[model samples]
Structure formats: structure tokens, C-alpha cells
Target: MNRAVAHPQQDGQDRPGPTTRLSVNIGEATAQVLQKHKARGISITETVRRACAVYDLIESEAAKGSKIQIVDRDGTTRELLLIP
Candidate 1:
């Protein structure tokens, strides 16, 4: 695996901690989705950060025997299942 250590910089000054630089190869469909987000004024970094936070919440709740569901406007409800 390839890895890079990065120092966070702001206002021409380096921050205190080091961050990891990640390189990923994504499929065409994923790229298209990212492009759509970009058009909506969202950066790829912010999108990934939000997605990670959501996934973390789902996994944490699932571990506690909770069921994830979606409710429609017509009073219809459906359960979402995740397989480990």
C-alpha cells in the first residue's frame, strides 16, 4: 500500500498535527455521483466526510439491534437491511 503524510496548512502557516493522504480508484458511476455533488457546490472532501459520519452512525445503531427504516409521504414504511 502507498501512503503519504501531510501537514495541514492554513493562512501560510502549518498546523500542529499530521494527516494522511489517501489515493483511491473509483468506478465511473461513483465518479458521476461526485461530479453531481461538485456541481451543487460541495467539495469531494466534504462529501466523503459527511458520508463517513452517516455510515458510522448506521453501523453503531445496527450493533445495538436497531432497525433502520424509511417512511414515505404516503404513510408507507420500509425497513433497510445491511448485511455484514
Candidate 2:
């Protein structure tokens, strides 16, 4: 039998505890992305933190519309949506 141990907490670490009981329904696609990251040895908390940080950097909606961009599977850039 194999047992997994929790990683030890080191001194001077500033990691936050998981949010208090916030439940969200993640769709299948999102679950796959999270699973992929986990398989690559990245913690879900870190992935969520990185996502929130990038999302925070996006520009706010002014009188002009916000631009939405996406890269296609074939490496082409496409403007998918615009919202004012």
C-alpha cells in the first residue's frame, strides 16, 4: 500500500487557506483544464490564483467596448466577442 503525505509548511510562506465554503459548478471543459494542470504538478489553488491575477489585469469597460481575443487551435488569432 502507498500513502501520500501532505507537503510540509515552510517558514515565511504566505499562502492563503482555501476560501470558506464557496461552491462553484465547473463545466466539463473547465474540469479538463484543471485536471490537466493538476497532472502537470500544478496545484488547483495556484492555477486559480494565476487566472484571477491575469483577469485582474484586463482593462475595464469604458465608453468604448472591450475587446475579446482568442487563438484558434490552428494558431490563428480571432476576435470572438466585443462588449461595451
Q: Which candidate should be chosen as best, given TM-score against the real structure?
A: 1
The candidate that wins on lDDT is: 1
Predicted candidate 2 versus true structure: per-residue lDDT over 1-84, tens digit per residue: 332233323322226565444468899999999889989987766666566544543333222455546668998987744343
Q: List the residue pairs that clash in candidate 2.
A: none
What tens digits encode model 1's per-residue C-alpha lDDT throughout 28-60? Answer: 999998889989987777666566656776787
- For residue 11, what is the lDDT in candidate 2? 28
The worst-scoring run of ten residues by lDDT in candidate 2 lies at: 3-12
Reference-based lDDT, each prediction: 0.69, 0.58
Q: State residue 73's C-alpha deviation in candidate 1, in Å.
A: 1.5
Error of 1 at 56 (Å): 0.6
